[model samples]
Target: MSIANQIIKQFPDLLIKKDEPLSKYTYTKTGGQADIFIMPRTVSEAQAVVAFAASEAIALTILGNGSNLIVKDGGIRGIVMHLDLLHTIRREDTCIIAGSGAKLIEVSRFALSESLSGLEFACGIPGSIGGALYMNAGAYGGEISDVLNSATVLTRTGELLHLERDQLAAKYRHSTISEKDLIVLEAEFALTLTERQPIETKMAELTEARESKQPLEYPSCGSVFKRPPGHFAGKLIQDSGLQGKQIGGVQVSLKHAGFMVNVGGGTATDYLHLIEYVQQTVKEKFDVELETEVKIIGEDA
Candidate 1:
């Protein structure tokens, strides 16, 4: 039997789709299809999929929140798993317990509603809770590592682990979760009890700053490059006069040089080529190498 057939046989009630276009799920709205798409309703179902993929030697890819990611035109091989159904958020004392699939922005608002501080920096970050933890996502001088208390994850072998903040080894848009291939199921964030008005005010300020600067009106994978030491990627790109430069349907944001926005029907190939061009131009002009913060995956057309 084929792998898809076997998968159905093993998990009869699990939600699955074959050859589904990933463009429907991505922020950029430009991606190919997923070979075997699975959306697990519960952690157990997610665990089973992981275990089965491991045992069968089938490549498995997790589609977290679908931001800061680019899937190539040829689509992905093997199974693509999304945890959208696992989203749930609740409060426990001074801590907020959130499922992996919960939106980071929603979690930040939830904290504000509960009169909690510490998550104000994340009010505009567009990523799932798990994706935020995986990448140590941050903005405006605060990072996920700052408020995270602990997390529950699954190893490739399907072993469950409850790891503390230190175990994550989060630093500047990076985490051990990627290195260890751990699947984040849920997270606990330790926040401070504060006046609701202050939290709301802080969030408002940050939101204004983000909206005024970022190219929020376009379909773009947030910041395209990581900040190099002592130099901002956007500044360098702007200094190189590469802003508004176009490659196919993708162009460097006229508003923000760090972002590559799709003016119209942009493709992953276009984005990749534009990224290369920007990196090359910036390197030649400023002697600084631009490394991508956005994760690029899938096969080429």
Candidate 2:
């Protein structure tokens, strides 16, 4: 049987898109086609799909909002399972139950409307809840771990488990989840209710700061590199005179040294080249190795 037929025979109702363009799924708007893109409608269905992939030894990957990721020109291999359809939020008294696929923006809006104070920092973060957990995404001194209560995850071996905040071993853009090959299903966050006006004010403040600092007008991942110890990545890059640098259609933003923008017709190769250029320049100028903040995946160019 053909690979397509093989997949269909196993997942009767699974929605599979053949040769789906990776550009449509990434914030960078650049990538080759994925062999098959799958989205399971329910968590159980997702679990079942994952198990089957493991049993069949099919290569698998999970796609979130694409906010913090870059798919290369050669594209992602095997089946890319997106759980964006699983987005749902519920308020259970003092805690919020959110599906892993939920967007941080939507969760922030809901939290603000309900006077939930702890999520204000996430108001402008452009990643899904699951992606946020994986990276421990944060802004304005607050992080996912600050409000996270617990999460349900599925191990690669198909075992389901619950992990609390303390158990997550979350740190700056790193988590125990990163160390393990586990898929997050859902998460619970404990929050305190505050006045609506204050919540609105804080959200607006964060938004304004983002607007002033980021090159949101361009298609780019938020920050290209992480803050190296004792120094800011953006400042170092700027100081190295690498801002406004270009590689094909990709340019290091004039507005922010931290971002690499798809100015007009940027490609994945262009972005990676720019990233490499920045890393090399910074290393040469300051003897500091700048690490990328955006996750680079898929095939090598």
- Name the top lDDT candidate: 1
Give the whole-model CA lDDT for all candidates, comma-separated: 0.93, 0.89
Q: In model 1, which range of ten residues has the least summed lDDT?
A: 170-179
In terms of TM-score, which candidate is strongest? 1
Q: Write the per-residue lDDT of candidate 2 for residues 44-135, one digit (tens) a residue.
A: 88998788778888788888899988999998777888989889999998788899899998999998878888999999999998899888
- Residue 55 in candidate 2, Cα distance off native in Å: 0.2
Per-residue error (Å), model 1, residue 133: 0.7
Q: After superposition, how far is residue 217 of candidate 2 from its true place, in Å?
A: 0.8
Query: What lDDT does candidate 1 reach at residue 90?
Result: 98
